[model samples]
Target: MGSASLWARTRGPSQKAHTAEITSGGIWTVAPQLEQERAVTGGGYSTPVGVTRAEPEVNVPHPQVDAVARRAQERVADAIEQLKDYLAIPAISCEAEHADDVRCLATKVRDDLSAMGLQHARVLELDDALPIVAADWLGAGRDKPTVLIYGHLDLQPVAGEEWSTPPHEATVVGQRLYARGSADDMGGWVSHMVSLGAWLAETGTLPCNVRLVIEGEEEIGSPNLERFMDAYPEAFEADAMVLTDCENPSDAVPGLTVSLRGLLEVELHVRALSSDVHSGLWGGMVPDVSTSLILLLARLLDDDGRLAVGRVEVDEARRAAGADVPLTPEIIREGAHLLEGVEPLPLRGTSAAEWMWWQPAISVVATTLPTPAIKKNALRQEASATLSVRLAPDQTAEEMMAVLRSVLLTDPPGGVQVELRADGWAGEGWLYTPKGPAFEAADRAYVRAWGRPLVQVGVGGSIPFVALFGRRFGDLPLILNGVMDPLTTAHGPNESMHLGIFGKAVLANVYLLDELGALGRDGIRS
Candidate 1:
């Protein structure tokens, strides 16, 4: 029987990619307000280095930005300390046991935002889900544009992962803070806090109206984020948004994520008999389901072991853009933690960025095949393997499934029964081209802080919230940035955030608000 079905689990990290979202340029969503708590206050990239250009420059540093930037620089150590406090909480959202930790972190953050003098800081609670922290400072007035800063308070679980230091204890080793959520999200938003706090301390008000929507379930793919958006839409409304949960191409090069691969998990199964049979009696007579399962899976890959189905053709412009990302095998080896001798697969004709961020890929995440502990001298009755597919940006789960079914369900070895099911996760990929003045505003801020403009980059990993944001607010400016570099190792052991990146992100944020503020409410979306 060649049947295709889906056994999707919409939430949880163990069964899905429980990661947060994207942006280097930025995104904006204008939604109707919903019921929410009140304690008000709030407010909230960039270029390459100083290559003098002939074009008239629009992103000059704001006069007040210098004061804020200086203050942020002074607060770097304190900022890292704050990050340490957040990392101490084991707020892994995927595990049920850690749900309280998630709420505890949200409560702590709500209290901190209130203490920071934001007008309204409160923890938003939804039934059957963890709490979300929402706050804002609207003192900048109605004319100034409101910039929403988004980040997650939850973390990826560190169980079974080896670490150089205690995973929950923030350890500074050579200017990098090692801890889960340090860079993946905590550092990304804390850097903003340092800048916003400095702005408040120096001027008593933000350069623009600002809103904070720190999520509690981002590490679990933000499964209920939409429900939160619908029930508390006020929490997400803004003239422009700065999504701070992406990665930098390098510590030296600030990346504005412009594209991302989506995620889809499918289980491929094969059965030759109702129950196990003695290998001595049936090895030659019956088809080995385990062997057949392996053979069928092989059909999904080219010699490179990459997913061969549902491939998309990239235009020259996209290829040229991917070429700009500074991804090398050495960087991948170091970032991905490949052993000394194990090398990255050959790039073949495509650039690493294209192969990673723009193409489909596959990994065998789980299998029901025999293990050493359960080895037996019998022909297995059935075998199954769960495949995690990274879909190309703009590719949908339905499109990928169609291609998979065509390749895997055609001819069966020994005509063994076969079935395919989407195990969990069918999150869409994101592809955005930043436009309007908000983007120019971002480039100016990045140039001032990083000494270079933001390099548009793409994320090979999937972030469901990003695609959701892209769909809900694709028309406006949404700047996606983060404090992560290749070496941060988010969702892995010894995750660290480069302090230098943290400092630069703080400075850039300081200038970004100033730049966006100058645009005015009408000017930003215009």
Candidate 2:
């Protein structure tokens, strides 16, 4: 039954590959239809519906773990209410106008932590940046491994017109709770909090010591996190870190994001004249800044829709790693929730999964120009745009920036003045082999909670702090786990959390903490 469901989910009616053939480069080149079958029954692949090529060798199930998970499940209503209260704060960290709101949200988090029995909870202020909430429960003693729990208190701005319900007002429709930050991290935060609260209520002690660091600026590329980490390194010290800020591939599947693409945001400005000129007077004589900027931006992507500038070529090993866990086109299409009649980018010989997770891509995110609402007959003197580049795991920000500069600035159209500036933040991508006691515990916990093996996946989005945490904590095992599903629509209209999965996620975290505590009891260090 599981195999049939896996195949059905992966194989659509139209996509059919020619044959199942392996190339000399170790990349699997199969027709789309055949690829779907291979993905379902092939070795090394696991699906959400308990379908697997190999039996998952998990740790012995903790006897009391089920009871703890059930307790967490029983508190779903309390968790939802707490998450609703959290989502009520319009903590838009990217906008400076919401500075006080963000601070207030941080304060609430600190107070909640204190209420949850962490007596040392306090707000840490760093220079002019927003405050961060930090607290620790060290009651489990030094023999147990200390685990750091990281989450964000900030959120993306909501588009009022696009939302069906008020963005700050949590409303339940079916099993989903509609609100801003309901899924893209406030839900995750509440999940951890509820799990901890349940454990404290039932046992009065955690299996491992816990340290919590909830930041207020994760949405803005975590601009102040590195400085905060540098100043207070000891506060974040732990054997393992659980970053509850990533999304699962689908609602049913539990995922561990093993890799994340880095980000480099650039602003390109072009000037052909000193000031706006009348188009009627200089229509033929003067070069249009908008035209020049468009041409310059067009050079960034080739006909294949791949990055022409700063392209990072994936080697054989990387290709093998990506291909080992292939994402079928059907899965990609469903996960993306693409608009009707829209298709994925036309990158030949590359699957949708590879293009998204393993390959580097560039996008023109925003353009600063005169809008149609404010139309003018005069030719603008300058045209500017914001470009975002998603770098692969093997690529470095410095090297890619140099390549981009070389391509964008080498030759100017009509000798127009072109200036490309690095827009303040550049985060390096992170990739780590999933191993160690923490990973094993996570595998067992996920299986126990979800009734399936955990799927290892890669996210194209950049979480700047994940890489920073690795650098600060000296390569501790970091688990990128969360409750958001593909339909959560985080950072978009009608953002929500699937309340059913949200409850399951709390249970999973409960099991995870229990499993980690077991490792501590055995004195096994990752």
Per TM-score, the best of the predicted structures is 1
Cα lDDT, all candidates: 0.80, 0.75
TM-score against truth, every candidate: 0.89, 0.83
lDDT of 1 by residue, 468-492 (tens): 8878877768899999999999989
Those runs of model 1 whose alpha carbons end farther than 4 Å from true positions after fitting are 1-56, 59-61
State the TM-score for model 1: 0.89
lDDT tens digits, residue span 1-526, model 2: 0011111111113322123222212233333543344433333443422223354444444455445555666676776887888888999998889999999988988998899787589999988888889998889988878888999989899745488999999999877899989988888878898888878877788878898899999998788888888888877888888999887766666778877898888889999888999999998788898999988888888886667766556655445545545455555565567777867677476545567776788888999778989888998999999988898876887887788788889888989999989877788898766666677677766654554457777788888888887777646778888878767888888888877667668767887887787787344453
lDDT of 1: 0.80
List pairs with backbone clashes in candidate 2. 16-33, 17-31, 17-32, 17-33, 18-31
Q: What local lDDT does model 1 show for residue 484?
A: 97
